[model samples]
Target chain A: MTLTHEPSGSTAVTSPPVVRRRRALTPTRVLAGMVRVAVAVLIIGAALFPLAWMAIAGFKSKQEVVRTPFQFFPEVWRLENYRTILDDPAFVRTLAITGLGAVLFTLLSLTVNSFAAYAFARLDFHFKRALWVVVISTMFIPGMTILLTSFIVVTKLHMLDTLAVLILPGAAAAVHVFFIRQFYLNIPRSLEEAAMIDGCGKFEIFVKLFVPLSKPPFVVVGITSFLVFWNAYVWPVMTITSPDLYQVQQYLATFRSERSSELAMLMAGSTLAAAPVIVLFLIFQRQIIANIKMAGLK
Target chain B: MSTTVTSPPRSADGTPLRAHPPRDDRIAFLMLAPVLILLSIFVIVPTIYAIYLSFFNWSFYQDSEFVGLRNFTNALTDPEFRAAIRRGVLFVLMTLPIQLLLSFLIASFVTGVGKRLGTALKISVYIPTIISAVITSITFALIYEYSGGLLNAVVGLVGIEDQAWIGDVRLALPAIAVPAIWMGLGLMTLIMIAAMLDVPESFYEAAELEGANWWQRTLYITIPQMKNVLLYLLITGFVAAIQQYELPLVMTGGGPLDSTTLPNLFIFNHFRGDTYQGYSIAAALLLFLVLGAISALIFRVLSSEKLVD
Candidate 1:
């Protein structure tokens, strides 16, 4: 039944084990093991050191940041640097706007995306297959290509400089739709079939049955969309001309230019911008990896 | 379909339908309407409009004029646009193979090790991928700073002189590339690891029985099995490199004399400038076409009947 042939059990029994075991400990094997350990260290170090440096730099004083011998940790750890960023009214406004936008985008995107996913996965409809393909194909279209024209659309709708500009356009992502649909497809038909026989309508089945069953995929989509909106820079930068409407990432980008000499301040802003998503990743690392794997398989 | 809709057969209770197929279609359509409409307005319309704008003399102040193919011609001849495209291609060439190779190697190594160690390494590697691109850029910018930069501080311990990593004209692209590769390595590694794990244990066991060494098993058994995932990464990673904007925008500002000006940045610059909007739109569309063609070509080349598959 398997697609590829497996080595027969007789071959495993007949193989010379002791000779091969001795051969495996040759100098090349030892050298290879050493190389592997070295590479592992290098990989882990490369991944971790920049993050560690950023965290340490966030606490260092401006003087200590650029001082000779390059202070790895602050000589005098300053909480004031983070305080400076946190106290700024503009930073507060940016965080509020970004947070609200992310929440709205997540709620809206998850609701709509899951509805469409359930429809595509469970319900029979005209052009269901064709429409699903269309949705999936849009996932391949690069965001940058249509960005300018989309900005124009937003402006025409008078959404420019409004949080709606951020939330509405991103409210229906193809990737989330595809991810949720894949999850929905795996749910057994028997559950929905049984529900239908109990006099539940499609919408009822969707709300009571589908929604209750697919919480993990929904959370993955919610977190993903939230992260995108929270971390969004290019769209907000293009559309948000009003200083009051700046998102955190845009605010931080500008903050870097305005105070380029203040390394500690900049790192503090980076930490603020990066922390929540990092925490989210930590909590849902397994689900995030699964989501990515799902994306790849498509 | 029309027969079912127009004059449905009566059910046992003399109802028009039993399961209500037409009603189900209607409900499905209702469920699908929001996303479908939003996608149309945001994605489909803008795509068509971008193509339309490519053929016009249009901007905020300028009067609209339909000048077919002129914008495309101008983009082709524009030196700055050409340089941007060349730099983008260079970035892709420089980063993709390095990231893919490193990620694949790390993934293989991580899988070969014990489970707890593998999980620890995976978590550490994957941490950066979740961080925003802007934050990563700023972090690296500080790290790339010449005088008190972390990289220089480390290298100086070994007596290497401090060099302006992002400030130097030749080094800026690669400097930007360092963070780009680092940010992506985690996700790539994870994807590769997942793909590697999909190579069935039986294949490895069988290969071991035949006296195949580790390298041989990887080459003959693992890689061949992971071709689709590898190709998937190849195309998507290539497309991502083509659209790169945020890292270079924040880190180098496409700087040290435009060494890292990706095509997306070029388009953004043109969009900001009043006169060059047409050229930007035209180039953006062209870049889209080029990306599509390249992805298709990759799919075609790698999708030829593999000996094992």
Candidate 2:
């Protein structure tokens, strides 16, 4: 159906193939292309400039950073800045804590949310529609509204100032459930039917059949959950008081607040903190883009 | 729903039909149980507790005293709270429109270019969105530092007296907004550009045949087609901008006369303070109600028009 419409529409509209092809190469077209190039460059430049500058400043001495009207490159590189940040026990501890938090939260969220999505997509049960709506409604509740109550709960449970609290509350994200459910709905039902005919139980079908075929969405959920949990600042900062339990973002904030004058160390810490996510993005660029498209589609 | 049973067709084995109830009900509930339990304990339960706590003057170290509606009354009447609301509204007003317009312009320009270039541009724009807000705040802090800062050096070159960008009470909020706007610009641009690209090519082709210039094509075919996406962006942007906490927290700490104290920061300070325990909880509750109401109103308006669909 798609191909039929394209060729038919093209043929019906144009018989002047040579003239039209020539028009495509006209001065107007060339000017248009050049303008597009310029615009692209400007857009790209705006996005990358700050990040590039941040990375460069990380390697520059404190004096070099503010010495002038922003020199693009530092005269003398200071690798010691990175070493100093790395050598700090607190810095290393926070990094481990953040990684641990991100990994634990990601795993827990994936299991719980993916299962919930499976139910929403494939099941017919009492209050199914109402339950789905209720879950989705939670997404509209701004995180700020629940901060106080969550704090009370955490304190009441006596789980405050621990990494467990950080990881546990985030395990029940409504948005992740919604995203995965929408993705599950898009999967064809034929696979499920085939599995059922082979005498596979519903749970087994989900694990052996649905789960195997759902790599893309799982990756999307995993990556996004990892990012959100890793970048979490306000929650971890509020709940975890000990420097030992502080996540990377919280640690960075503390570093900035305490060493306001140490620009090089701060920048180096920031660079190290952001490196893992950047590496993940670089490796899974296509999956990330596809995931974004999937999100927007819903 | 009705269940019907039919006899199995006789095969060589002559197997009888098996009437098994749909397994989906059991499986669905099973799948959803863990998530529901977690959410109930962490999110839903906390929310209910927060509402309960808001009505009282409950401190961490003292006996709980119930003073119904007093905290809400105080929050409404307090000048600082009111000022925070005003500043938040102003910040939203300043940031959302400018960011949206800039992002849309950038996105539209990139989409008009070819796919390869457009993809590269989109990635560059999206990179900043991925960088932690802490990094952006620090970067801007360096840029806005009063003495020997990049901004000061630039002002010096222009023969203007160097002014403190973030330290000045009057300029602190706006200075904070610069980084917020910059951090958000790329993601907003990518989304807008994606929406613009979703417009059917036939619309542009038709406009071209009618001798519509580039501007006309963009206005008629592009803008109109992206109305839904624009509305989504506007509402989401408004909500996000109002709740802005990271930049102001990291860079200004709502300092220099409370110029940059957003509602979230106010709530954070209250919750973080050891003395104001119950009052902080109360304040957070009040803030949540106001924000929730605003969000609901926006969502209602947008959904009423079916903008999301």
Candidate 3:
């Protein structure tokens, strides 16, 4: 009754993920499909309820948001809230700072990670063994454990309250180096070899042969890093004191805490903060999802 | 794949194509120096400094006094520290199982349907994960409002009285955990769906031919085949849930008689301008060791354990 051997022996060499369909339309089969579709609707509903509720509440009038009987949709939509928030200079600045830091972090980390990953993936050096241990071992060392001391370290270096504290401390993450390195290893060496035979230097070879060929991983990791920076809360809270310097998540937290009673304001701010990441996720979702599934397959 | 990527470095069969002349070694060093120097300054130095600070009564203001293990001893006996550890464990207990079960059931259905519908379900379930937890908590806060909230509104239809979710001590922890659990569902479900879809349909066909009912077929085939993925998710979930800082910090503020004061918040309470900063560093180090041991044990099990049905 073992299936490990039976599956490989099947005559049908179907493509992946081909669920065997019931050939005849039995009543039980129809019922099962109906039940599954019903569950899908429910699962999607539960997953999206809170976010949809927030967006809906953002459009409600001040008095209508907390009305005793809940209205699923606002009676009179308040589009002015979005307009006012967008017109506010301070709010615009917060979005700008958040975007600036996220873009900087993504770009800087990609270079640092690709360089280090390239070294490990393609180079041979004297201390390659010991150096790799030095790099990768730090992956297990929890960032929380080092938070207090890292704060002290950054403060001594005079990085507190600056964008450097946000961008640089996270720039050379061991995990990214490892992830990109794993991707780098999968690429065929022949391309690089051909470039090498063309009398191209190592840097030239990497630029020509590797960078152009490695767009997918860069996109995947770049998007991931950007969202991570955008969503960062704890470190920015600890390091930055100025309201002007607050990142997107920090701004959302401050908005809700200082104005917890104003349901409309909080929802509007939360929705705004969630907007960019949401848009980005929708845009690159195909690649992101394919990467996630590929991660599982690996 | 392991998120930590702690697999040992490969044997020197690595660089056969590229010749490693002295000039190449210099180039390699130049490329690696950024990662190496940053690691030393940030990660390596801080880890060593944390251990160093655990011995001394370090403070931002006054001269730090050297006390031999007094901080550790104080943290060990501290009631708040014990409760924080327990709450951290409580989060893992409350969230991981329910998320796994929900993911399993949801994935089974999603993968069963047509492909386009399945993709739509996956995207809807996963969209929330991309949003920041701080925003998610705010969204949850409105939903968990004492009056006119969605939860209360729904329950009122069932003739149940409205509940103070984050305001009540008994409900605060679970309330704080809900948004976090919800945020995690997309990733877990996506991972689960991938794993479930990977299981060969022929196996189920064989079981059906053997007269195995749907439930029995799942038990004998699907569950056993998905064990490694399940275990992987469990370990990652444990690690992730225990680090639950943002949700509780945002939703409940660790309030209602400190009912939701998680371990990280507990550490923050001490380290952020408290006189007991030394004790906080020590406690953090202690938690690190415990988590480190657990992670190591997981790696051991992952590498060595044979699959059995």
Candidate 4:
């Protein structure tokens, strides 16, 4: 075959002819390409339309939202829905709880997971393999099965209905540690050895050397942890009953039935609750995708 | 990176402190202490307790009674439990292929398009994935709302009557799955794209030179290259589907004759009830074991994927 004779050479030679062939497509090929684009557009549109509609409706009056032959955009962009949401003490408390809880838990989990990851990746210790096996084994266990027991544990600890229940349980995750460990494993050991020669301690080496070099993964893990705190729904709702300690997600979940009847107010709540994470995602799309790809590599 | 460690200046004990091996163990333990403690209490203990609790008549308010195999046996005969499992499996069977195929198509399309265009399309899709489940679920519930809902509005355009999407018994499960399929598209696409890019260009080049068409080359080369990634997605997707909750729980609330009630929702409901807590635990434990075995099988492929590399 021509492939065996000149694999690289033929590829090099085929580009122009292929482009010319594509430029002079038969009716079928043209239709095929158009169909491909059309399907892609349709999928993208479907994916985005609901989100866009939620945002648009968030700014509309309730009467407009329930009107037949739906209004795509509000004639008058009303801030009343948002004002109503913001005026609720429960909403304010939830926002604080979610925002503050995310910050605390993200920081705490990142510290714990990073230390564990570094130890696994770089350090030699007794039962290193055994401890790692124990830690990584939990990844196989679904969190749903443990939900009831975890509730029992938290209740026994006298933490139910408190922010502690929400913040403490997710303070460490096996997968985050696993991802960070993979990144740490790829670091050159000589970087640490060189630091040792310079009279740096292990903590210093980790802080000054490994931490700086591993910022991207750290950021990835941070965002992931922050989201764990932010977007957590089922667990928080199951545990925290007090509106005063409710996280934003649990607060949002409460908008069903009675509250969801005020469709505009509900959309406004959904939009506000969704804004931070969505904005973060838009800002860090590249880093997030690259981090996820790194995960696949591991 | 040299494996050899450099000796630092001597300490008061006449040891090169920086190069000392025992300190590594101490430091490692010290660093790992907080996580191991938390995990032991939350993850490890809860897991073992769940297994133990499955055999007992347990609830929050009452003293748990040891029931031996009663809970497990009851689960075997329970119609609600069986229906939940069936619905969960049906949901997975329905959604997985649709999600995977659509994601694969989008991933390939993104790769084939120009850079700016690809980025725009990719972002548009991924936007849905990052939003909180509560937001997406609520948004979809509104979209599926009967009166002045988005789905109704769109169908009305084509002269079709506005149907009760989430309220209709026959349509509830599938209606709930639509948002799931939409939300899942982004992450799956990203994963497949990464997997596709990892395939060596030379394989495609060689196939093309051999007169293999685009689809043929994709079939013989691209698909094989992506085998493990696809398997990874399959395992995770299937496992997540098995544990499906939150979305349908929020969207349909397992309503319209309990048509959308999934295994997890069944577990949640029974657990929430005064009695049947033991039954719920048994169901959850069984689901856990089944998922664990499936995950183990796929994890082997993941490891072998590395081996092949």
Best by TM-score: 3
Off by over 4 Å in 3: A1-16, A19-27, A293-297, B1-23, B296-309
Off by over 4 Å in 1: A1-39, A294-298, B1-23, B293-309
Residues B1-309 of candidate 1: C-alpha lDDT, one tens digit per residue: 344655777543233555645446889999999999999989888988999989998877668888899999998999999999889989999899999999988887887775656767888898887778888888888888888788899899899999899899998998888888988888788778776776767788888899999899989988898887887788879888878899988887778798888999988877877663666888888888888667645544543543101
What TM-score does chain A reach in every model? 0.84, 0.86, 0.89, 0.84
For residues A186-261, what per-residue lDDT tens digits would candidate 1 score against the true structure? 6778988888899999899999988987766776787778888887888888888899888999998888888888
What's the i-RMS of each model?
Answer: 7.1, 7.6, 3.7, 6.0
**How far in Å is the alpha carbon of A289 misplaced in model 4?**
0.8
Kindly list the per-residue Cα lDDT of model 4 for residues B97-185, writing each as its tens digit: 99998888777776666555666777788788777778888888888878877789988999999899989999999998888888777
Q: What share of the true interface contacts does candidate 4 keep?
A: 0.62
Error of 2 at A209 (Å): 2.1
Model 4: DockQ score: 0.38
TM per model?
Answer: 0.88, 0.88, 0.91, 0.89
Candidate 4 structure quality by residue, lDDT tens digits, A244-264: 788887777777666756889
Error of 4 at B148 (Å): 1.3
lDDT of 1: 0.79
For each candidate in the order shown, give its overall lDDT on alpha carbons.
0.79, 0.74, 0.79, 0.78
